[model samples]
Target: MGHSRFRRSIVHVNATLARVVGDEEGMSTAEYAIGTIAAAAFGAILYTVVTGDNIVSALTGIIGKALNTSVG
Candidate 1:
C-alpha cells in the first residue's frame, strides 16, 4: 500500500512540474546582452568615482581614525 502511494505521489509531482516549467518564460540573448553592457557601464562609472581624489582622501581619513582609536 505504501509503495503504490509513493508511486502515485511521484507521478503527480512530475505532471505538476511539467505544467509549471512548460508555461514559464525568461529573458533571451538580446536582453542578456543589454543587461551585461549596462552593468559594465555602471561598473566603469563606479570605479572612476571611487578612484577620484575626494573619495580616496575621505576613505583614508576614516581608516586612519579607526586605526588611531584608543582602547581601554
Candidate 2:
C-alpha cells in the first residue's frame, strides 16, 4: 500500500540520518573544528575592533610621547 511505502521511506530516512549524526563518539573532531573556526572568527572580529583607527591612533600617540620623553 502507499501508506506502507511512505512509512518505510520515512523510516529509511530516519535511519540514514541517525547513522550520519548519531555517532557522537566519533564527532569530537568535527565539534572541535567547528569550535576552532568559530573562535578564530571571533578573534578576527575582536582584533579588528581593537586595532581600529581610533585605538591605533591613541596607541601611536602614547608611544610617540613615551619615545620623545625617553630621547629628549
Best-fitting candidate, scored by TM-score: 1
Backbone clashes under 3 angstroms, per model: 0, 0
Tell me the spans in candidate 2 whose CA falls farther than 4 Å from its real position: 1-27, 70-72
Predict model 2's lDDT versus the native: 0.64
Tell me model 1's lDDT, rounded to 2 decimals: 0.65
**Positional deviation of 65 in candidate 2, in angstroms?**
1.2
Q: How high is the lDDT of residue 42 in model 2? A: 51
Ten consecutive residues with minimal summed lDDT in candidate 2? Answer: 12-21
Q: Predicted candidate 2: what Cα RMSD to the true structure?
A: 18.6
Query: Which runs in model 1 stand beyond 4 Å of their true positions?
Result: 1-26
